[model samples]
Target: MDDPRDPRRDATSETAGNDDFGNEGLTSSDTLELEFREALNLANWTSGNRLQELGERLEREVELAARHESEMAPRVLDILRRNLASAEGASVESGVFQLKPEIVLNALRNVLFNGLVEASDGTRVTVATLPVTVVQIGVCLTSYSGDGDGGSIGHRLFRHDIMRRNSAAEQDVIDFLGRRRRRGMDTSAYGDDDQPMGISDMLCRALMIYGERAMLLERSERPWRLGHGGPMPHELIVGSGRKEMAFASLEMLRKLLLDHKRFIFVPSEISDQTVVTIANSLQPLQYAVLRDTTDIIENYVQGSSYERPHYKRSGLYQAVRSFQVDAGSKVLLCVYRASAIAPGRVFYAHEDHVHEAAQIVIADAALQESRGFPNLIDIADRTCRGMFEPGGLSAQVHATLARSGSPFRFLEERRTRP
Candidate 1:
């Protein structure tokens, strides 16, 4: 489709084997950046201009970390597979819960901060979902970057080749883009706009603006890596917020977000297919859905009755938004969509609503030690609802007593993948 609003899924490069619009052939120099900058300017969105500015700053990041290239998608999926696999490490058996706590911690942390992205509206150019948008932008740009030849990670990310192989990583980008998208609800804005961006279009916009920002953040701030699966390298603290207002550590942040039986974070990174593949590799964890909520520990205890109906059933057209299992040892997680707290309002709406949700897998941990329990509550403070990437690692995980000690193995599930 020639329309700028269209995703240009069929927009092949004029020259064979070129993906960066045509800048793939450009020599590595100021010339290449300028060429790409002009191409993004023609993207016909306000975010495009911001992307052009970002291109100037991102050159250094590309030069320094050229090590990360086309194989980006696999790294993300591999982490998911290993972390969630029941047979490999953790097993819920004989009613005793055991696991390598570090593995679970890493998986949860990686998904929470790294997987999210931010997107600026094409119409108003306002940034939305800060870290998540940048992550998506970086992933898309990396896909378009390709290898020296024509092949790119996009082939692996957006295409079905990986699934056809019947491999461990069960899903691809296109499937994720289709199934995991967060659409505009009728109750909110974008109700009557001539064109409201789909999940991919918003991703494309993020590809323009936040992609550049992520690259710049990588070089200037010097963020470290959780692992190869993460979207961008992150530093301890990157913003100008008070340390008192952030999460004490990754450990505490995990506890706060997953405090409930049902939650909805952004599962922007891991696909359900990957969860199934990991489930297959595991011996103990059973991947099953709630047919009628009989197995749940509790019913929808909170939220408005409209969204928190007593009955939920997965269907051909309508289905359970999550797949959950008791991973033994009292660890129960549901990658679910439910009426959650509102954002940017700065006030807890007495009424609850389950607006639009996909599966954002949350990390659940019931721990005995939390030194800064008073401080850890800052993460969900209703005062700063609009704050972007609210309370990042640097601010949240400071060097003070707020930081949690390395968790000892509460219980180790002694099982290897068969």
Candidate 2:
């Protein structure tokens, strides 16, 4: 009736008729856009949850891989154990083993550098991944220290004996001794004019300082103690008279044992009669008589029956002969000494054992050296050939030289030409 084709009439009719439902089309489109945005947000939330789940799964897999690797560690160690057994001069008895020089040398290298586990102390074990040759040189150097002058000459000559020996360690020993000498002037307590301290006294001081330092470096490192949980046997060689020194040494040792509650002093010179007397006197600590002469050790081995608790043996002679050139005789003496000392524990007849125990040290040194390895084979050849000349300094130098062929030749040529 309002004439739909007429613009003014149509507008007026539309406005009046639909005023309550105005803009219904625009409202419907706005509702649809809001629904679409809500759907998008939900999808995004689902994707985030999936990503978090994936990340957690990857972390678990990594942990599992590490665990599997750790579990396989022991199996890998078994291979090294077999290789050690087959090495030359190794004796395996009931799965227990003993190593001769060459074998021992190799074993040390394997443990220190080659990644072989030598021994464990609950928390961690010492591994040898170092070259065997390098360990040999370290042993040689340690032995040289026993030859007097604190191994200064030997250290210099053997500087290049190992390919990876720790130069810093060598320098440390040098610097420490140098500083000690220097400080003597500042402090009258350790002056040269002071009467030389007894060996036992010196040992006590050394042990205290060494123990403290060792504890600081490695808190788990334990002190040497006896079966009753007392200190290890230590003696002080005092005075020129052997018997007097022995008696004083024993008395002081006993006192230390009593005071420390963990030490047993093995007298360096207790005879059969004295051994019995000392055993009777000392209630808690075990006793061992240290014989200076070979005859005394032989007498105890042959004469003493199983009735005596204290063992009698020659320690000084064994220490000396263990490093001698004549292997046949020296080896025999070492065995004899070991038999007399203890049937069970690993008795170190030669300084070689010490070298074997610390084989990694040499390898570490070699790594630090310019040439990069300890020349132990050369050292052995030179030692066997007696290429090392003899003099006070020469003996020390030769001992060091004997541990490395290249260094020995270089030093020898230098000496000859000079």
Candidate 3:
């Protein structure tokens, strides 16, 4: 028989084993020793007023952030007003910005009940209970190197797929799956950098190229291409690339910033502090924190070097205007936090259209298990992962090289660690 109140028995039990000491029971003196060591280790840091000083320092940072929001909000709003005024299709009411929660709710209500989503450009899409068409792009890469002074090479794969779902039937179309092999050091890349590019950079270029290609295919005369009306359907394109609208590379961002096609690019993740600050500033009284779309800030430069010669001379802006959209009722969806686009450069040209785009994203995201990300993109990502699994290409290449009777030992591991 075991004593239920025995601490050592509980600690040693298979189902209730202790994490730190395992099944070993600690004596009173051993516990005292641990406490003494902990106190000794923290003595200097916990001594005088160190904690108070640290708290004060953190509070100062918070205060600075608050002050930054206060000073920057008006400047950003002024820029939006100026840009809207200069745009060709600017309305008389374009200067007025909507910051209230009721306005957003009204828009959402109309979308849910009226079943008619009217874009600012007068493109009215009759809403079904679900998306009539869904498009998603996926990309994956694997790299291999000769076990010598020779450089590495990379193989990349990209897939563009569309799914049509309605009451009648559901159909899937794998439009294209592109495959490319490139030297790791190739510098004739998208951005035209003079320096040799790495395998990771090659992967980024693949994503950008694949995304652009997907868009091109969408506009093609294929029977299943999007936005053709009559027989062809209208759909939103989702990408499994960068969480930011910028995608992975700058050149693709430049094209997206300059082109005004029927598209919406939303970042699946939000990490930029400036974007968070913008969301915090315009947070409305009705919604939970940072759940509403923000007033657009035109020509939003991403990094600090917007004034540099490389960017300024070519007018290449890495970042465009962005808005926050928290689709989750109480918590944030894991896939994305916000979306952004070029000012006056996308088909969703005006604020109302941008808001409509956000609403559409929220609606499609609701149908998926993730609750916040579009299902088609998630499906495409999974399909790509399944098809182009890690090391799958590498293993085949290594086997082929082995059978080719290469003189050099090319498949040797560079480094090994325990």
Which candidate gets the maximum TM-score versus the true structure?
Answer: 3
Q: What local lDDT score does residue 247 receive in model 3, on the 0 to 100 scale? A: 31
- Give the better candidate number (1 or 3) by lDDT: 3
Over 91-210, each residue of candidate 3 has an lDDT whose tens digit, in order, gives 332331232333334534554223332110001111111111111223322111122111111233322122223454322222211112233333322224333222233234334344
For residues 1-418, could you state the per-residue lDDT of candidate 1 as single tens digits? 0111122111221222223333455566867677678788756443754777677658966754333322232343344433434433232211111123343344335532343311111011222231122111122111111121111111001211112323434455564444224433222112223233222333333233332223223321212111111111011111011121111221222231223212222212333364433222221111111122212212211241213332222121111112112211223222221112211000000001111111112122111122101111122222122222223422332322133442222212432224
Candidate 3 vs. true structure, TM-score: 0.36
Query: How far in Å is the alpha carbon of 347 misplaced in model 1?
Result: 26
Error of 3 at 199 (Å): 4.8
Off by over 4 Å in 1: 1-86, 89-261, 271-418
In the range 1-418, model 2's lDDT, one tens digit per residue, is 1111122110111111223333456675796787678878765344754788768878987886555544443333343334534543332210112222343245345443333211111011111111111101111111111221111111111111123336699776675555445432332112234432222233333233223222212231222211111112222222122323334433443333323222111122223543233222211111111211233223323433312332224243332222122221111101101111221111111122222222222332233233222223223223422322223344444455568653445343446674
Q: How many clashes in each candidate?
A: 23, 38, 2
Query: Per-residue lDDT for 413 in model 2?
Result: 45
lDDT of model 1 at position 393: 22
- Candidate 2 regions with alpha-carbon error over 4 angstroms: 1-69, 94-418
